[model samples]
Target: MKNSKGGIYKRFVKRPMDFILSLIAIIVLSPIFLIVALLVRTKLGSPVLFKQKRPGLNEEIFMMYKFRTMTDERDENGNLLPDSVRLTRFGKLLRSTSLDELPELLNIIKGDMSIVGPRPQLVRDMVFMNQKQRERHTVLPGLTGWAQVNGRNCVTWEEKLSYDIKYLSNITFLEDWKIIFMTVAKVFKRDGISTEGMDTAEDFGDYLLRIGQIDNRTYIKGLEKSKKIAN
Candidate 1:
């Protein structure tokens, strides 16, 4: 297949699919939403939604929502505990079942996300994507994408970026639906929920030790690529 030069038609078709599918999901999944919200409120207390700032397309920051899957348990010094410690059995169920991600339907409706695209990352991770990886943001971030259904958080950052770039080059209506179908299967099987040797996917800071940060050389290289795309 020829590499897609992303354009208005691509974005236009993708957005409507996102909006319609997200709206249907929100409505169809309302029962599960209520159940999770109740469980989270009872088990986790106070705020039911976990809101975090994640970078979307072009490294833009947006608040992403998920069902709160961890507790705010603090230690003697009043500092928060690690994710492993804070993650409870109930939380594990949510994470493994991916029920925690339902609230992101709103993000799709609000235009912060798509049903299929590169998964959004945190500001810290985006900063590390430096210039090269930042190009992944040329399209809306998604609930699921090439990087996600392929290996998800299980893959190394470099591997994930390679998939992201490939998706950028080949995006099409047909390709998006293919990714969506793959995502459904991955979710049902709960594949790649955790990276090897980590409780959850380790933070970017942790991954950097193994893969190295996007240094100045890579940034300049990425800049050239981004310029080529822009032109």
Candidate 2:
């Protein structure tokens, strides 16, 4: 296990530190947690927590947790509605305030996440990543990261990948603290939470193609074939 320093901190020291800090954080933040839980239950109705599978260290899939910030509204045919419609004003508030991300601190306690590192992406979305980009998984995913504090959803996927690579190469105590401080400021300013008009970040396929992970012609052909099969 790599520490904030290039050399690993003694497990005796690091694990205990993680435990103490996580315990204190949970205790100090419990009130806020309760309030968020109540608000999610009252406003979103059911499922006060949102859980999804995310790649952790070494690309291992783990169930990541978050506070529920969207409704489970479905159409008549039982298909889910679009994000924009299912995402309510309260949900938007949770996102803008980043209250929805609070539950991930529990993941840090569980040893599935770090306090600072590259943010995890879904396994489904990993299709766009080539073998090289897969190096981000060498370290544990984080609650907030360098790329996130930099430009987040406002930046293209390639740009985010470059930041993630740079972070991996330059992991240090100072860098971690720098990212943490920047994250606080970014959250306060509510910067780069989402793309300009999209409910979430835009699809990463184009960025992948631009980086030569996939050729446009091949990408188009593959999509066309898939659509033909579906039809």
Candidate 3:
């Protein structure tokens, strides 16, 4: 909290650095973006961009964007299929290579996100966070954060949140660049793209309920809140 070296960098340097880096990244990656968009359109069919509402700094709602990775397949009742069912080989490739996350560079440019910080979570999942966990929102969410560079979808929600808090407590330019380089290495290795036997991470609310952090009533309430937001 005090204006230590890390705090000074966060307060004065982080945003401008994020802006410049993200702008340059978007420019450099524009061709990849176009190719991915075309591939998504051809494979997934329409809505090439996956847009979702996520909580940003101070829990403000903002639209997060990614290249669409799943199909619009539905069940007999017309409900959408599960991610495991809809995610194709190409989609999995996109995720494993971190290409799907490219669109978030725009979020960084828009000030809705940072180049490095805590990764954003669903607005619906906010109810599961304790006051300490909620501290992650004190700064902008990121395209890749400490948690992501560490274990990403392989780690438990609690572990990921701990990493996020650790990053927040010691925000420094050197730390961020370290995380960025680590993220690139992890991407190349394709590590922790998803936990074993799962295509995506489990919901935070379900994790909280399983860990007895939140009661059944609270979980239901969170689901209801999520539905209302969707509507």
TM-score of each: 0.87, 0.85, 0.94
Candidate 3 lDDT, 1-231, residue by residue in tens: 122334678989999999999999989988999999999999989999999999888777889999999999999999999989999999999999999999999999999999999999887777678888898888899999999988999998889999999988778889899999999999999999998788877889988888898899989998998777655
The per-candidate count of clashes, in order, stands at 0, 0, 0
Clashing pairs in 1: none
Q: Against the correct fold, how does model 1 do in TM-score?
A: 0.87
Once fitted onto the true fold, the runs of candidate 1 whose alpha carbons sit more than 4 angstroms away are 1-9, 210-231
* TM-score-best of 1 and 3: 3
List RMSD in Å for every model shown. 6.0, 4.8, 2.3
* CA lDDT of each prediction against the hidden true structure: 0.81, 0.78, 0.89
| Pairs of residues at least 3 apart in sequence or in different chains that clash in candidate 2 | none
Better of 2 and 3 by lDDT: 3
Cα lDDT for residue 184, model 3? 92
Q: What is candidate 1's local distance difference test score? A: 0.81
- Name the candidate, 2 or 3, with the larger TM-score value: 3
Ranking by lDDT: 3, 1, 2
Candidate 3, pairs of clashing residues:
none
- Model 1: per-residue Cα lDDT over 1-231, one tens digit each: 222357664756778878988999999999999989999999999699999887776656788999999999999999999998999999989998889999999999999998888888765555456566677888788898999988998888889988987888777888888998998899899999988777777656446645656455665554464444433
Residue 163 alpha-carbon offset, candidate 1, angstroms = 0.8
Residue 93 accuracy (lDDT) in model 1: 90
